[model samples]
Target: MAKPFRVDIVSPDGLAWSGDAEFVVARTPEGEIGILADHEPVMASLAQGVVSVDAVGGERIRVEVEGGFLQVLSNQVTLITDRAVIEK
Candidate 1:
């Protein structure tokens, strides 16, 4: 079983998501990046693309992030965004 990490997705408006995830994949200025529990620390500028998180139940939740900054530290991930929408 994979360890779960805290992931928070936020925009200028407010927090769009707050939960635990096994993995998170998103686009950064450089390219696509994947984060797992106990991942190495990182900070990067994000691009316009989809941000997906694998939940405990193995279900994937995706959201569109227009532009933002992503910071990963310890077992926590923080997303600061200009715009984002939950993908149906």
Candidate 2:
């Protein structure tokens, strides 16, 4: 089993979501990127699209973001965006 790591999605309003996730996929200016536990640290510019989080419990949470930045370090992923909405 893949190890879970922390994931936080935040917007100007506040924290959108924060929890343990097994995987994450986000849209970036360069294209889509997938992140897993122990991923190499990285910082990237986000594009307008959906950021998907595969939660530890097998739930998939999707967040629609306008634009922002994504940071991954020490088994944690942080997404800071201007605006975001939780997609049903």
Candidate 3:
């Protein structure tokens, strides 16, 4: 099982979601990237698409991002976007 890492999804409006997740899939300008706990640090430009996060308690959270930036470091992931909406 993957260890949980801190993840925060934020938009201009405010913080959309913040929690600990075991896995995260995000679409970057280069391609789709999967993140796990203690992954190598990365900073990338996000593409307009869905960012999927597997929460610690088996809950899956999906957020629609209208392009932004993603930063991963020290078992933490932070996504900043101009606009984002959580998908039900």
Candidate 4:
């Protein structure tokens, strides 16, 4: 099993998600950023798109995110945005 990282998605309105994820894929200005457990430090500007995550239990989750910033360090990923809606 792979390590899990903490992924927090916050919108200016409120907290969107706070949980553990095995992997995450997001659309960034540079293209796409994929994060796994214990990934190296990284910072990228996000674009208007969908942010997807593979849950610890293997289920896939996606959230619509507006333009924002993605910060990756150690085992943490902070997604700061102004708008985000979790897919049901």
Candidate 5:
């Protein structure tokens, strides 16, 4: 089984979601990027689009972010946006 990493999706309102995920896919200014556990540290500008998180189990988390920044380091991913909506 793949190891899970910590992911935090946050907005100016507050933390949209925080949990453990096996992988994450996010849109950046350059393009879409996929991240897994122990991924090399990076910081990039996010694009206005959907961000998807594959949780430890079979669940998936999706959020629409207006625009922000994505930071990954030490098995942790942080998404900071001014606006974000959790998709049901």
Candidate 6:
């Protein structure tokens, strides 16, 4: 299993979610991408779609985003979007 990484999501309004996650999936202009711990650094423009985060202990978090940017570096993931809402 991959190690957990810190994940932080933010929108124009404010911070949406912050937690430790094992994996993440998001839509980008190029296509969908999955992130794992210890992965290579990346920064991409996001497409309008749902962002899925697999948190520690098998919790799944879903967020709807209008548009944003996703960045991964040093085992930290950050998402900044124009708009975002966490799904119940």
Winner by lDDT: 2
RMSD of candidate 2 to the truth, in angstroms, is 0.5
Clashes of each: 0, 0, 0, 0, 0, 0
Show the lowest summed lDDT stretch of 10 residues, model 2. 1-10
Q: Candidate 3: where are CA atoms >4 Å away?
A: none
lDDT of 3 by residue, 1-88 (tens): 7889999999989999999999999999899999999899999999999999999989999999999999999999999998889999
Greater-lDDT candidate between 2 and 3: 2
Model 2 spans > 4 angstroms off? none
Question: Which ranges of candidate 1 are over 4 A from the true structure?
Answer: none
lDDT of each: 0.92, 0.97, 0.95, 0.92, 0.95, 0.95
List, residue by residue over 1-88, the lDDT tens digit for candidate 4: 6789999999998889989999999999879888999888988899999999998999888999999899998799999997999999
Tell me the lDDT of model 5 at 23.
90
- Kindly state the number of residue pairs that clash in model 3: 0
State every prediction's TM-score relative to the real structure. 0.95, 0.98, 0.97, 0.95, 0.97, 0.96
Per-residue lDDT tens digits for candidate 5, residues 1-88, read 7899999999989999999999999999899999999999999999999999999997998999999999999999999998989999
- TM-score: model 3 vs. ground truth: 0.97
In candidate 2, the residue pairs with backbone N, CA or C atoms under 3 Å apart (3 or more residues apart, or in different chains) clash, namely: none
Once model 3 is optimally superposed onto the true structure by TM-score, how far is the C-alpha of residue 38 displaced, in angstroms?
0.8
Candidate achieving higher TM-score, 1 or 4: 1
What CA RMSD would candidate 6 show? 0.8
Q: Residue 81 in candidate 4 has what lDDT?
A: 91
Name the weakest run of 10 consecutive residues (lDDT summed) in model 6. Answer: 1-10
Q: Where does candidate 1 have its weakest 10-residue lDDT segment?
A: 54-63
- Model 1, range 1-88, lDDT digits (tens) per residue? 7999999999988999889999999899888999999989999999999999997778789989988899999999999989979888
Error of 2 at 50 (Å): 0.3
lDDT by residue for model 2 over 1-88, one digit each (tens)? 6899999999999999999999999999999999999999999999999999999989999999999999999999999999999998
